[model samples]
Target chain A: MADTMISEQVLAPIVENRAVAPDHVELIISSAVLSQAEPGQFAHILTPGMLRRPVSFSRIDQENGQVGLMFQIVGDGTRWLAERRHGEVLDILGPLGHGFAAPDPTKPWCLVGGGVGVPPLYAAAARYLHRSRPDVIIGARTADWVLMAQDFKDLGLDVTVATDDGTAGHAGTVMGPLETWLQDHPDGQVFACGPTPMLAAVSAACEGRATAYVALEQRMGCGIGACLACVVKAHGKEHAEYRRVCTEGPVFAAKELIW
Target chain B: MVIDVSVSLPRGLTLKNPVIAASGTFGFGPEYSRYVDIGALGGVSVKGVSPEPWLGNPTPRVWETPLGLLNSIGLQNPGMDVFLQEDLPFLRDQNAVVIVNIIGHTVDEYAQVAARMNHEPGVAALEVNISCPNIKEGGMSFGQDPDQAYAVMKAVRQVTDLPVMVKLSPNVTYPGLIAQAVEAAGADMISAINTLVGLAIDIKHRRPALGGVTGGLSGPAIKPVALRVVYEVAQSVNIPIIGMGGIATATDVLEFLLAGAQAVMVGTVTFQYPKRMNEIIEALPQVLHEYGFASVRDAVGQALPGRAPIRGGGQ
Candidate 1:
């Protein structure tokens, strides 16, 4: 937690840049500056362009001083980051924003991630050592889009996959299997990250029966809170107010979100 | 040797230095505290505030262009009531010069905001925002027309005792004429040039990239245009000029100052690095010294055509 102070850190030469799935790549860089990163915290990766691209930390390996960031090649900036070679240094501002809370060790934990959202959950699963293993549910558009299934399996946690086209695990949104899992483990708490609609569905699946947390995505200007570009409608104690996703949260409890 | 970098405007507004954080970039003041010291800046021109709370434009309000950025935030800001209650007090605590940027759809609306601000104790000055390119009827509409610009400045002047600096748009062909009008109408100082109107296409989607369709372009890309306006307007008006548009480094600051600006405002670069203004402020003394000047005033208008050479250096 102490190392979370914002600093311009260097990315150690890329030791690995492998394709994770279609249009997605997993980048591994060594950096001691990001050691305090807990689950759900993201880094603002600087590009040669004007705005810094915010990418969540998929894995924070404190022992080896390595941090893993997975991103899809959606735009020019991401494509630029994907083209970097070994030993090329990148500027990053992070260990930013509030991360997900540490769930109770005695109770079951359910982590629901959709598509690119699947990566951030891996770090949380590895960090949370508990009596019961966590249920990792991933949703993708098709069989070709499913990622990190083997990585979660290697961690020895219970893994579930749901593909929209019926080419993978549950043949629908991950909510179907997630709802079924909730019925059995009714005492579990859920944590989800994905597109807004998926998060809305996950929040609905909890339905006052369980507590849930969700991470939101917004177009950001200054990765710091100054620009007020990445604001979300959040319910405060008195009224609805704008909360910064970069500072207040990228991860917020489902009940507090206006959506 | 310590160099005195302070600057003084006509209305007794004295800044510790010449570098100011431009409006619409630095939020009321607390957001950038984590990275830089707010007190270190000469002044903070806050986001444009209207008479009422504005919800702003839809999603995808910002886009990146080569060496520049296009943003149509539509002057989104909490109204004056919230600003006075919440933002102003925080800025006062920082002890930096607080210049409030105000906008309106009509002349009365602009006057009402200034009148309200006139009663506020901590506000050091009023930057009449007649130049924002994003809004529909009031922004550039008031700026591009000299008659409307004079009327707006005159109305705002009648309401406020505090110093009023009219921020002008670069979109005008004869910004000099507009500067002269505002000066004659009762403007204490002038700030030029606001972002130039621009647009970008997604290409793949075959649609405009910005949600607002068009946005105000800023950054190093518009620095030349900013210099041109500052140079032209400075010769036309006697009031102090606060130059802005695409300013980033200490060298850029020096360029604006030499081009006949009393002070310079930094906008777009703040988005890239929140603490960049501090970096520019810190390096100014050395940069000024390298140009063989002891104070900021010594360099003002050094690049103007008719300026005489200094005793120690040839122009």
Candidate 2:
């Protein structure tokens, strides 16, 4: 109840809305209040439906007072969001949930992301650029489906891409490069955001050898932690307890997850 | 002119306004405090408290239907000990009227929670929840059976002197029969209706969308059914009725009042707009004036059968 981090609900005007990839739209909204958002935290966007869609902050520009949201058209909600035009206002509740913690300065770090999960890593990479460049690994179904590889590269971070069809830079899942990275930097920390299977793989690879922080996704309602709708199973005393993916995480240390 | 929205329920439980945040959705008062003024709300029916901390169901507990939401949260709470030690103190600090919604797997458990809340400071009333559809045992089972419902209410009534409002379920064949049974068992008031049991399939996975397989349906889609249940229960019981289910606007609140609900609980809509209850409370006076009703109490039972002719400017 006594929230140390303040989150705001605002009707932010859409400054820019365009397709960044196939069926993926990068929506930028003008909200000086939300520009203060941290990486891995999400914005609960009001769609043309009863429920709000929780989208991660793909890009945060504090100087311009804009927060960018990227999402694919998965259903009526995301499809409706993709159809929104520039200048239209979106009801957004945001900068919510605990974001990825800043990595240790002296230690080496790498980022791993998959599909839509790649966006928050881009925000993380943007923050990491302040200290030194961190390695980034992105995975997608094909070369065309790969998202934000160039975004990370433009940030001057060493980037590696993997696709299921062998059409992109290291074919197969992100595990190949992740395994190699873990072998080389045994003490390196990993920050990841992706599908559950890939995260479980990354968690397995980093176990006992390295540390990993993963950003998770789930179907959510009232992204402000009021509704206990979006919960993820985690190790708890006596038994596994359901933790709020919207609050206790969207970002959790990979070691803490049950999966 | 100012409209008197204050509602006086049985056992000295009086609300400054007619809008109470329903259980489960509001999350014990503090969750929405940043977006809403907790003290300004009529009352907050905290999520169902059992004797022990419940972990609830697995993932994918909620699904979005057209104009509605389906949830199978399974009443996850920190139990009576945590409620008194952690949650109730925060609400007390806010000076908010608290309505503890008690749930149990057995009649004894329900009475145990009721007994625990018996003289707890800052608690205005106890909302006995025997209508939740997510649990495997008790909950909706008690509400669906009149005799079982009567037994649960009677047990809680014996332990607590606070105004007890039994939340009714629409999934039953005759909600009024259950209402009358609880009334006879000494329930001071009734809140109709709890969410309707529903299902949504994830076509891609060819499995149920929610982890619970089925969940309680709530939102704008359930409003009409809730209104119907409120209208029916009003005639069956002499105690005041609190109508809730899909109330999103001041007009919706007034509709419940006309159908014999003394006050209304706002649930699913608050998930969409965190500050919605405050907005509805702010808009009620103008809406009441527009309808030629002097106050919230004046509009009660206006639409009930055999009542005097509708006397309102809008009509």
Candidate 3:
């Protein structure tokens, strides 16, 4: 059998693993491969029992080839992974899921994220910060759910925050603050990542406003496309045809996306 | 390293290993080739398709239990146009035998699909899956009724010079009757025990696990039923047998071989582990070596001690 994934066991030290904002936990896996991965991308991390967990590529060390993955423990697989030691080799399949696209050098950019979705924004933000930092807004359920606030601040991007409980930053989903900012910064392109509901909300918010790309989520079976298991209706399609979440995208344009 | 193990049907079709990726489980076979070589398989039975396109059953079409999975995919596939235009080119590149499995509502529909497939260059055989209940008349009924099974096979036999393998439903009360009917009508081979009729109650969801209400159950759970069915069908028919229900390992492949299957098909396993077919193919030869057989032909019915060869027993 042809091994499509060139795999190697890696010992990723948990640089940080804690409830950043309640149930969500951001893990900066210490590895050289992380650096080679781009910002809008992700890693297919093999959890202890979960088989393979696709986490957002929050950040990467391109020169060192290391990357970071962040996720919320939603099921038994995540629970099993959470019980690992700080220094451990978590067998993983990586750089999975289409990450956010890099901004055109001449064009302005905007980034919007929700809760767990915020992690994918870091890599995108880091890339553009070299010349010009993009405007960024992240939403969370409550003040406590706003993770990686300090990390975003460190990236030197024009960052804004929104929380439903109003415990921190502007209170509400990222859309309220993001819409206000985008209306003023009309020229900037948009990139977003979040749960389906959150992405849907943002997609609606960005309607007819900005060209936005969304990282869609579905209950994936084989994070590779073979199974045709995780398929969703493609937008504007007559047949109600489906697209594979793992391959064609865990990412798509908010406008091109059907659901 | 796992040993190379594969099986081919009695007709001498070359399979990489005996572990075939089942129809409906491995979509068109090309998609899985990216992760693992689909060509290195005993073969890949493409998802069941009809003359016209099938929208298939509604969602909640699949659910996982403790160790098994229930599915009512109803064989959702792009019609023959898509198959020939989009899938065939890619499938031709794959090394495995491409067994184009056709499904239909009426006898004529089956003829039409087989006719199209018969002319296709890369396809090695046409597997007529009569187990699907989604069709109008000749689907599950064609499998359960001896007369209907013979009629469908006769129509297909008349249309194509290509080899035809009739896949039987495990839901039948008399699988042997259906086997005999197809054999009499000139089926080249038989793939025994399609998903047995099964249902699961979603206690938490407070309804059935599938939107189809009743779905086919497959996995490790159904292997025994499939084995028993293969055993019975093998003794009853002289046509070569392709046995598959819930095959996962090489040893499991042997169980079907001994039960009278000339070759074994693997379904449901790839759904759980995408490269599981790889594991079986890689280790199958070692499995054979362990069994002290020079070639798979010797191992075919070795599992069925005294299950004598009969008229119309094999392809």
**For candidate 1, lDDT tens digit of each residue in B199-314?**
98989769998778899998899999999999998888878899998898999999998888989999888766777899999999999998898988888889988864212110
DockQ of 2: 0.79
Instruction: Give one digit per residue, the lDDT tens place, for model 2 in B1-315.
Output: 978888877777788999999999999887788899988999999999999998888769899999999998999988999999999999999888899999999999999999999999988899999999999989999999999999999999999998899999999999999999999999988999999999999999999999999999999999999999999988887888999999999999999999989999999998889999999999999999999998888999999999642221111
lDDT of each: 0.85, 0.90, 0.72
- Which prediction has more favorable lDDT, 1 or 2? 2
Reproduced native contacts, each prediction: 0.46, 0.72, 0.15
Q: State residue B140's C-alpha deviation in candidate 1, in Å.
A: 3.0
Against the hidden true structure, what lDDT does model 3 obtain? 0.72
Each candidate's number of clashing pairs is 1, 0, 39
lDDT, candidate 2, A74-130, per-residue tens? 999999999899999999888789897788878888999999999999998897678
Could you tell me which residue pairs clash in candidate 2?
Answer: none
Across A1-259, the per-residue lDDT of candidate 3 in tens digits comes to 0123233224466665555656666566677654556566556565533135667677777666556677777776666666665666665554554555567757677878888887777777776677667778888888777767788788766678888889888877887887787788666578888767888887787787777788776555545555555566676456566666666677778777765
RMSD of each: 3.8, 2.8, 4.3
User: For model 1, which pairs clash?
Assistant: B219-B246
Of the two candidates 1 and 3, the one with more favorable DockQ, higher being better, is 1
Q: Candidate 1 on A82-166: residue-level lDDT in tens?
A: 9886677777777788887788777678989998988888878878745447889999999989978988898887789999999
Please state the error at residue B288 of candidate 1 in Å: 3.0
Best candidate, lDDT: 2
Model 3 Cα lDDT, one tens digit per residue, B1-315: 344344444445656556677887778765566466776677778888788887666555665554566666667778887898888778788755888899888899999999988868888888998887544456787898899999999999999887789999988787988999998998988987788677778777698766678777778888889988888887788778888987888788877777777678787766445667778766667777787766566566665647553322223
